[model samples]
Target: MKPRSTLVRILAMATAAGALAWAVTAGNQPSHAATGPVADAGPGYAVEDYGYPNADKILAEKGILLKCGDGYIVLADCASEQNLLRFLARDRADVCFKVTGEKGYLALELESVHGVRTSDVSTTHLEMTAENDRVTYDIPAKTWEGVGESADGREHTLVEIRTTK
Candidate 1:
């Protein structure tokens, strides 16, 4: 019902004011930690995000790469937990890791792993693969379960474990 000419003028004024305010704020120093955009962090600010910290140490000493995980389940030094997932390989006597959350994930290949222990509250899924064969498993709560050895006794490598809530 209002005049179109008057509406146009008001809108134009508002747009100009908003743009001017934006320009002014854009140049001003930020009042808080700039969660928006960083100027530049410079060289050596980069970090490896795919794997756990100090993964190299574990690989060199324990023969486990521990490339990456969802962080719910994680690698702990031996004897860190009352019970932990255990693997027996031809190359090593045992390899192990601890789980922390009700649901979690880990990606690794524990060669010739014959067994694993399960958490009390979470259901576990284990996957293994050989030259041309692949296998999957589900372990119930609080169980020390057999894996590659139990499943036809094949020397399969563990690829991934996905746990869910």
Candidate 2:
């Protein structure tokens, strides 16, 4: 009986010592989680300016200054498709845009614009600058309207276009 009791106490002490050693070793080891601010170099933060994408390249190649927009309206080829909003200018080739979504807006600069053709899906509102005064023209859906220099006798530069369904 005494020998059996002594063996039980020895086994219990060994287990307690093994557990304590394991706990101490684990407590001394460093963890992988971040405990403070790190000074390591990483990828830069992304910032969106929203001015216009590829604006400099487009202006240099095509002589068109597309400043900004909501990305719903985009420039398109005149002969690309039907139902496109088209613009006519005396000094340059015909400029056209494709309108999508429920509404669209674009700010640009086109010189000597004389006419505007609205698409069949939405009404068009155009703003132009003649001398120092601002001129606005509203064209209904699926219609051809005289604007800018053709409407008045002065040369006008198209500045903005807004459309709604």
Using all chains and alpha carbons, the TM-scores for the candidates as numbered come to 0.66, 0.74
For candidate 2, write residues 48-117 as lDDT tens digits.
Answer: 6655678899899878899988887888899999989999899689899999868998999988999988
Instruction: Write down the TM-score for model 1.
Output: 0.66
Model 1 agreement with the true structure over 1-165: per-residue lDDT tens digits: 569988999999999999999999887956666554455554456765667677788778877767688788777655666666656567676666677777788887677778777765667898889768888998886788778866686678888886654
Best-fitting candidate, scored by lDDT: 2
How many pairs of residues collide in each model?
A: 0, 0
Q: Which stretches of candidate 2 lie over 4 Å from their true place?
A: 1-42
lDDT of 2: 0.89
